[model samples]
Target: MDQMFQIGDSILTVSLPVELDHPNSQAISQQIDEILQEQYIRGIVFDFGNTTFMDSSGIGMIMGRYKALGMRQDSIRAIRVNRRIYKILNLSGIYKVMKICRQVEE
Candidate 1:
């Protein structure tokens, strides 16, 4: 499946695609920007259950949202991240800015 976005309780949950490369990352970033402009989002949750590959563009996209959200603590989250993606997130220093979870939080 492609990327999907869901919003609830002021949080935006982004269900990422299997491959988060330059092409899709740019599109996803634009879509998320539109959503941000239209809604009163308090946080963002990136769901990586179906994602297996991610490039630097993906990391940049997430960071863009972090900045868009005013860099609030716990305002960004990564859930269902696999080992490979976890390593990427960790090495990209995303762990320092966002919450990384093995499972979705309620």
Candidate 2:
């Protein structure tokens, strides 16, 4: 899985691969953690334009990040989600904590 992080003044944007399943969840989590530690991140924006699959591990990863940022009064957001993934996010209750945006697919 490939991941990229964009450091911003207030928000750290994370772009993850299309398949965020068990195989790469750990790596993704580690990457995110490292970025959070290395930067003064106030919020996270997850770009889901490329993500196509996710599992329980992905949910755990998101939840863990949420907790990590919660301590700092930060927030998380998601963009460019497809229909299938949107349903997963809804069922996982991520919508309660993160803002959802309909971005133009790249």
Compare the candidates by TM-score and give the number of the best one. Answer: 1
Best by lDDT: 1
Q: Can you write out model 2's per-residue Cα lDDT over 1-106, one digit (the tens) per residue?
A: 1338787786878887889998777887898898778877788888888999988898788888989887444388888988888889999997787777777442
So what's the TM-score on candidate 1?
0.94
Query: Which 10-residue window in model 2 sums to the lowest lDDT?
Result: 1-10
lDDT of 1 by residue, 1-106 (tens): 1339998899899999999999989999999999999989999999999999999999999999999999999999999999999999999998999999988763
List runs of model 1 lying over 4 Å from the truth: 1-3
TM-scores, all models, native as reference: 0.94, 0.86
Would you list the clashing residue pairs of candidate 1?
A: none
**Which residue pairs in candidate 2 have backbone atoms (N, alpha carbon, C) closer than 3 angstroms, thus clashing?**
none
